[model samples]
Structures are given as structure tokens and as C-alpha cells.
Target: MRNTLIGNGVIIQHGGADYYNANIIRRAINNVRSGCFPSHLYPKECADFVTALAKEHNAALNGDYDRYVFTTYDKASLKDFKSRYDRKHKHSPEEIGFEDYFLLFELIHNKLGVKNPERFEHSVVLRRMFLDSVFNQGKIETINERFSDGFVKWLENNDYIFTTNYDSNLDVVTRLPVHHLHGSFNTLSEIYDPNSFRNQLKDDLLDGEEVDLNYPHLYSTCLVSYVGDLKSFSMTQSSLANIGMKKFVKGYQDSPDIRNQIDEWDESNVLVKRLKEAIRLKSERPELQHSEQYPHKELNDISGALEIIGLSPNNDGHLFTQILENENITEIVFNYFSHQEEADAKRLFGSKNISTRDVREFWLDVDNK
Candidate 1:
């Protein structure tokens, strides 16, 4: 029988939950509290928005709400806010909405040039230091090397690979095609410029214009939204920008400069267009639609069994459901980290036509054999 391997963020030892919480989320909180960006570089409106956002996030981190607070708001608060937002706007709270404020800050920073380029350069260096502390290393690299070596050999011998991670560790370790469902950090620099929007937004008259949206990364746009179990919103870039403007900008939508910038970004944004097309296709063909691009379609087209590693079905219920219902998938192996995860996998995929094993145990068995 044929087989396909799927992976998620947990596969990246040092770059998983721990790294994100420490380097990205914690760093953001600390930066906001300490005023990492100079006041001179911030316009009054942008400064006020960041200050308010940071304050709210600080309150949430202090444990003001009972539920896992991934961001500045407690889960309960987020749910309520989402409910109100959906009812008022006639749309659901998307996963991308959570990161809108952060993206807005990045956009504003680019719009207003840095007051001191030297200081900004120093800050970038310092920021990289923090990221490196979590990402660069001995043990993590060793594990990644081993996993990639084994996994790539298996894929080349048979089947395909799909992952829902943002890192390029898999790409670096193997020459084989490993599809990244989520945007990757490696492509971030190519798609976005923190200092200016010239490369991404500006149209070159000499060059034949083509918006390459496929394999689009995070840095491509200020508006980013992800659809999940909750009611999905229109994934178009313009729609998302409107949602963001309403949520973050308050009365600034009337500003010509802000409107023009958003419009330019929307026109050039390949990711947004891609997502919109996916949404359209999903609507037209729900049963066959697996995910935005490759994950869903490829999984459905698989002629054999599937092996899942480190992916939680909570955020990807639709994809999981599709896999279970696909007649082409004759068997499934779930490699989980914990008993609870195993239980959850069983609950989702069921006992029949499915097998469960700890990730470590599975790897050890593979190595020993």
C-alpha cells in the first residue's frame, strides 16, 4: 500500500511552542512595555493604538480572564468579542484577526521612516539575538537532522510529505518537495520589507507585472486571516483590510494616505487572492476541498495510508474530517506526544483503520528495525 506523511509545528524541537512563546509572544510584550521602538518614529495615531493594545495584552497576561489566553485577551473575552464582532459585521472572528493589531504596527512602522537608522539597525541585531537564543542550537539541530534524514529517505522511497509549519528546517534538510501548508519564515524576507513597501507594493513599469501569490509568505501583507471551525470570513485582502481598519484604525479609514497604502497592498497581494480563490472553490465543492492549496487536495488524492505526526486536530478539524472520510485513505497512523493527544486522535480518527503510537516509540522502532 502507498503512504503519505504529515507533520506540524511540534516536529520542530526548538522552534515549536516553547520557542514561539518565549521568543515571539514574550518578546513582543517586553518590547511594548519597554518601548523598544522610538517615539519619534511613531505617528501619534499609531503610537496610541500600540499603547492601548499593549496595555490590554498586559492585563490579559496578568491573568484577568480564565481560559488559555494566547494573546492579550482571555479566551472568554475573545469569544465574547468574536460574537459581538461577528454579529455586528455579519462575519465570524477569523484566526487572522488575532494578529491584525501586530501587522498594523508593522505596516505603520514601514510607512513612517525610522528616526535613527543606526538605532533601528542595532535594534534589529538585538532582536535577532533573542530569536537565535531559542532557534539556533546543538540538540535541536541534531534531532532535526536525524528526523529529516529518515523522513526524506522514506518519502523518496514512497509517498508525499505535507507540513503545517512556518520554518524551513525541513526544506534545508531535504531536497525532496515538502509542502508547507502555512507561510514560512524563509520566504518572509523575500515578500516583505520592514523599512519600505517598494519591493512588494510598488509596480515596476519596466518589468512585466505578475503577482506571484503561490507560496506566498507572512511578510506579504498587513492583513492576514486564517479560517477554522468557526464561521469563516471572506478571505480577500480587501475584505480583511476593511475588517482591520474597522477594528484597529477607528476613524482613520477616511485618511487618503492610509486608504491608498491599503489599496496598493491589496492589489499586489498574491496570498489574499489565493485564499479568496480557495474559499470560492471550497464553496463550490465542499466535499473535495481539503485546504487552501496543497494539503487538502493532495491528501484526498493519496492512493494509500497516511501517517500523522505532531498535528492537533483542534485547529484543523476540517482537514482531519476530510482525511477520515476519504475512501483512498486505507489506513492511518497517529504519532502523538501524550496520552491525551493519543486519546484525542482516537476520538477523531476512531479505533478501526487507525493505529496509535508515541512519537518517540515510533521513531525508536523505525531506528531499531
Candidate 2:
């Protein structure tokens, strides 16, 4: 009763169910505030947090004591610290996630004083994160020095990669094309000068005098933009208003020439055109374009399969579906983490070529292939 791949014409649509897999701001926040680590207030609350998180998503421990070693404290300093700490600290996704979250929090709470403490107390871990003022303040620059090639190496060991097309060469030949979805954390400062504003103001105000205001705002804004709620323009509006941004917004909004120029600004520089071109070329000649010599293109083809992996399937990229349908894809293999996701994928693509299975088995089959 199942369709099968019998020839080159038969497109074998295989999709691995993956989360966005990025250490986004929200995941980072929950990792820090999840109370996974013991505190004076919640002394025996380790398993509770870990268990809850595990039920929600899959976690792998390459080493047992990894978490303990990484996040260790002086046990001898305390009298009642009897539980054995693993000390191996394998850098859980949550752990890395927390660090990213805390950096954003520091940008906002420490620099911008713009955190919703009330929301923090009420299942904050479960809520969707928004790009806040701290993000708009450019705090991402603070972590630039810390994010070197070494971090990329560590991320490879941990199965995390940058999704962006630029920033580093990142052995595109062998490894899973670690797409740093966002721009590189390090290049951010160079891309947007941290002290550009202060330097300009000083130049305008003092003519030639040496004026230096520690550009913490620059760092804060970078971080804020990285983690800010892009859907709402309120944060940027308030941010601009605070720094006398009325003229800039008005000029951009009012001047016809400015508006015309703005339309040409490719502000995000998302590389959509390049991707579309690649897809068009690949679709035209799948044999040549999908060759092993072009791993990035192959990955793109994999990502563009009828069944999506980490995507939420809001149909934002309906073209992928159209391509699959037009090619007459009769079957799709999807690895679902839970029954709910399997049911959901089935409901959404039931009329098409989608079949859900356990992630573990899917990987096993992949290995054999």
C-alpha cells in the first residue's frame, strides 16, 4: 500500500524532524532560569527541570558528567551538598542556550532595564521570545571576542552550526553544512560599528576634541537587534524616539527619493535571490546540480523536500511544496519526535507524499543507505 522509489525519476523524499536547532534567545533564557541548577530556595530541583524538558524534547548526553564539570561550584564550601555532581558537563543544548539567553538578558536587564520581570516568573521558558530594546542596543558585540574559530569547532562537536551563508569558510566540503542561520556573532560589531553614533555625535558637537563615551549602547543595540521582537516596530520606535530619532524616521518615511532609495536598500541582505537562483538552476538540471561535488546544493535539495524537518510548516515557503508536487513525489519519509508531530504532519500533508516514523529508526535507515 506504500509508494516506493524504483528509479532515478522516483524522488526519494527524506526529511529528518529537527527543531530549528539554533540557540535562539528564548531557549537561552529558559536554560538559565529553568532552575535546573540547585539554589537555596529550591534545593533538590534538578530532576524536575530536566525531566520536564526531556518530555518536551530529546536530549543527548555524550558524556554523563559533562554538565557537572562545566557548571560546577565549590561543593566543599557547602555542608549539605551530598549529591554526586557528574563533572563531565557535555554542554547540553539547554546550557549553551542559557548562555545565549543570559547574554541577551544582560543586554536588556543590565544595560536597557527593559525586561518583563512579571513575565519571567510565569512559565517564561515556554513563551516565544521577542526582540527587545536590549537587542536593539547592540549588546551582541560583547561576545565577539569569545566567539572564535574554536567555538565553531566546539559547535561542530555538538552538532550546532551557523545558518548564514557568510562570516567563515567552515569546511563546506565534508561536514553537515553548519548554516549559522543568523549572521556570525563575531562579525556583528564590525558590520555595525558600536561607537559609530557616539563618534559622530562627538565629531559634530566638539569639532575636533577627543570625546569618548564607552559605547555600551552600541553593544546593547547589537544584542537587542539579534534577539529583539522583529514583528513589532515599537521597540525600534521607542529606541529612535529616545535618541531623537524623529528626524531620521520622518525623513525616511516622507522623502519620496529617500523612500525610493530605501526600497533598493536590501537591508537584511537575506540572499533570497541567490537561493532562488540556485533552486531554479537545480530544478532545471537535478542530475548536475545535485551532484556530490555540490554539497551545499544537495543540502538545499534535502531541505527543500516535500516533508520539512524543523520547519513549523506555516507555508511561508510554499514553493518547496509546489516543487515536490510538480515532480510528482509519491512518498516522503519524516522522522517525528512525538506522536503529536506525526499526527500533525499527516494531517497537513496527508494528501501528498508524507509518512512519519521514529527519529532513531530513520537515522538507522539513513546510516544503512
Winning candidate number (TM-score) = 1
Indicate the residue-level lDDT of 338 in model 2.
Answer: 70
Displacement of residue 310 (Cα, Å) in model 2 is 5.5
TM-score of model 1 (CA atoms): 0.49
Candidate 2 off by > 4 Å: 1-179, 183-307, 310-333, 349-352
What's each prediction's TM-score? 0.49, 0.29
Residue 158, candidate 2: C-alpha displacement in angstroms:
21
RMSD of 1: 13.6
Tens digit of per-residue lDDT, candidate 1, span 151-172:
5565555556666554555666
Model 1 residue 35 CA deviation in Å? 8.9
TM-score of 2: 0.29
Give candidate 2's whole-model lDDT.
0.32
Q: How accurate is candidate 1 locally (lDDT)?
A: 0.45
- State each model's CA lDDT, in order: 0.45, 0.32
